[model samples]
Target: MSHTFDDQTHGADITRLFPEQATDTRSHPSRPKRGDLAASTADALAAAGAATLICTGHCKSEIQHVIDHISRKYKKVNMVFVTADTSSLASFHEAGRTIKKMGLQIDGFIGFPSVMAVPWEMTGDGHESHFQRNYLCYFLLVNILLDDMVHGSRVVLVTSCVRTEAPAPTWVDVRFSNGEDYHCLEGYSQSMLAMILFAKSLSKMCGDRSIAAFSANPGNTKTNVQTYISMDQMESWLERKRIEGEEIPVSLQQTPKSLAQGSATILRGLLDPDLQEESGAFLNHCQALKLPHLDFPAGEESAQALWRRSQEFLGAFL
Candidate 1:
């Protein structure tokens, strides 16, 4: 909940980051709807010869809208949604049931049977009980997807952002499968780090042409996720909200954009021709963002370490 980035480091050069231009400019003519975006993206990917489309999260209606548009326009592009709930196992199971009932054939799945306690247990003890349940879901979801990497599929992992400088006001002494006890918000950081590592590993294991992995931050948008916060916290957030506040620039938040608009960047990454050769890079708003250079370099070694630990923790189900 803390919006402070006071202690965070920002060395990524923003000037070098730019979104890829759409091939057919008219199809995407400025802030298109979910359907139009999907149609344009599907067309682009088809033109580029992409085999399948994989999308994450609970935006089924939006995803379906886009697919329907694509089918109408292109006639023959396959798409699938791997519904996942990072919140709890119960939620994920429920989603699975829904997907099954709808009779949609999901080619692959990456989800938890229960929520992870790593982030909560590593955030520090004697804080709010709810914080443990809240942030831990993100870790659970990412771990699920990483465990289910197929050799020849395009994988997309979606996660929310936890401000780097915020105090992880929960428990802070949990041991991961690697036998390391992390402190502060290290669990959240580890999850993000693990995501990149997993992607890098998958790329290498599959000989670069078989698989691709990428992570995306959806940015702050109006969604059902806000409902998870308590009433008191919600009121506090509203009270802290300002017409022109320091937390979020007014110009950015006030724009006529919805979550669908925010998802455009993600769509671009999955469809852009330029990205086919680009692997192991974190993307935002359809542009490659420089990750915090970790002590271990990005390659197979880091990926193996992360994969081993994740598999050990996730157990045989993955």
Candidate 2:
């Protein structure tokens, strides 16, 4: 049977997990409504002198609303829609084709892959495996961005925080080619490392003209991310916590902030004037924040090795 975990439940659990860190105050100050991201994007484009935009994701209605909003607010800028399941490179290419059909010169491309995944074994090493998946998603996005940059197009990598210092239920066990299974811990670590390395590599490769690689970790926002965890799983997890006398309230379990709220930081990263100077840095809540300490560094050798291995594993798909 399909089970679901509501936002309220998950939010409460998250708050209880890190009572000190999870504040009741709304995480995003200028949180946009669902369709407002487009207006924000237009404003960002105006500020950056960008003439065109390309967006990728399944949030077509939300994204389209943003585009329509932009058209109404700033009719001068060009917008192109590319629908693709970003988890797969094939989807990305398909999205690219759709964008080409729109007949707009692509000035910038934004990638938001659906969900994060990483080898499960990496978690035992004290790594955030979810972040590892995130990092890989970003890496693939960057690969597309770099190609765009080579052809003279700017690109933005959009992401969010799936794991915090507090404990949460892990729903997936991602396996790597090395026959290693990584839980959530290692996945998060690997993902972040991949992002860092991707940024560093893009900066080095393109120098000043490198496509800017900005990372944004939106604070708590209500969304469907918790759907991956079932009520049964959440209850079981909560039961375990209750036995330990954890002071978690049921109200704290609400879904994260709305997609608009969660997208705020990412929108800011795209629009912030200061970001030009901080291209390779990760931003948290729309502010430049220090990179979290990663268990593994995605150094050049490591990335090259990963690319080679992944290519071999995927074979012709590579």
Winner by lDDT:
2
* Native RMSD of candidate 1 (Å): 11.4
Q: Return the clash pairs for model 1, or none.
A: 122-172, 123-171, 124-170, 124-171, 124-172
**Where is model 1 more than 4 Å wrong at Cα?**
1-152, 162-193, 224-257, 294-303
Stretches of candidate 2 off by over 4 Å are 1-50, 57-74, 97-107, 116-147, 150-154, 162-193, 224-261, 292-304, 310-318
lDDT by residue (1-318, candidate 2, tens digit) is: 122223222222222332322221111111122433333433444333345545555556746666676566656655555555434455544554554455443334444423433234333322233533344434444454343343333344554442332232222323433335433323433454455445545545555564455655544443333444455644654565577676444443443555445545555444334456666665555566554331123244554555554344334332
Q: Specify the highest-TM-score model's number.
A: 2
lDDT of 1 by residue, 1-318 (tens): 111111121111111122222221111111122533233434444343334444444445645666566556655445555554343444434444444464432222221111221323422322222222332333334334333343433444443443322222212222433234332233434454455455555445554435555554444444322323454544444344443252532232222334444454444343344565665555555555655442225344555655664455445333
Cα error, candidate 1, residue 268 (Å): 2.1
lDDT of 2 at 198: 50
Candidate 2: 10-residue stretch with minimal lDDT: 22-31
